[model samples]
Target: SEMMIMANWLMARFLSERNLPAIFRSQPDPKERLYNEDQGTLFQNWMQRRLLSRFVLSSRSERHSGLGLNAYLTATSPIRKYFDLVTQRQIRSAFDLDTPYTDREIERSLHSLEQPMFSVSRLQYQRKRYWLLKYLEERIGKKEEALVLNRRRNGYQVLLTEYLTECMLPVSSGVSMRSEDMIQVTIQHVNARKDTLSVYMA
Candidate 1:
């Protein structure tokens, strides 16, 4: 949390000092503005699209997995996390007694550790995502060419002018278009509630 706060501050300072074109400006209180509603929606759409592409279409081998009991035991931390330390002590006790914990006990210990780890990981992920979106929001209202990557039931996902950033052009958002059509998009969304950009074929 501290790191994320510091990063936000640093970005604000950088943007201000360099006269950067960004969707937001620094406030003394550390609050940020998206510069526009469309930009926010575009950013959100981009993040969701990128996440879907990477996770849903990526190779199975690229996914994370635990090997087995050893993997589960090692995944829990012995320091810093309370549940991890407790689990470690329990496992150590069983080992010292020449009777290891049952599979169910080990599984339960691992399950108990998952919630905290996932919570921490998700917080970090969201913080990073916000920063990245802020960076792009700075470029709002600019016309850019993009490629249509996929057509959803409601809209199509497009790769933005920048590399790797994908945003959805939802039909409800007023871009009634088809897939594989190159288009010029004016950033129409960027805010705390949404991160998206609007587009139409040039």
Candidate 2:
């Protein structure tokens, strides 16, 4: 199923490219900046990050206010993931007994499901983070262009050019910077044991 979804997305991209108008494909007689200072106001609503919540349901009725029951009822997962087996068992038990799990019971089950998954995710992040710090440590004292992504009272976050990896820039480095600024920076510190990389404006 995942392969099929990926194949379909690839096909869509190919088709979109093939169907693009010739004018869009050809070089402009005189290229112009795609966006200008005057248009900055048009993108004011763009946020760096935002969280979203959604509820899914299967059926709707007057009493339900048309919100409907969960449509994910028929969802299935392969045996590889433990949660799928647990879900299959719970669903079978519910149907066989003619009584679905209570809302609180379902909520508790879902909440508990996150623990192992989060552990796995954290482990993978730590592994990658270890390699990133090691790579940066070898390049200490080297300079590179970076974009500031965040600012705090003590330090800021900068994304390096080559790896696009983020590292901290301490205020004590005496290099003043603001978020979203592009500037040349040098690695000032790297603690591979702690998976930390620190930099200063070059």
Q: Estimate each model's TM-score.
A: 0.42, 0.50
Query: After superposing candidate 2, which stretches have Cα over 4 Å from the reference?
Result: 1-47, 50-80, 84-109, 171-176
Query: Candidate 1's residue-wise lDDT over 40-154, tens digit each?
Result: 4544444443333211111001211111111111213458655435434444444474344444554565566557767997988777767767766776676777767677876
RMSD of each: 17.7, 13.8
lDDT of 1 at 131: 72
Best by lDDT: 2
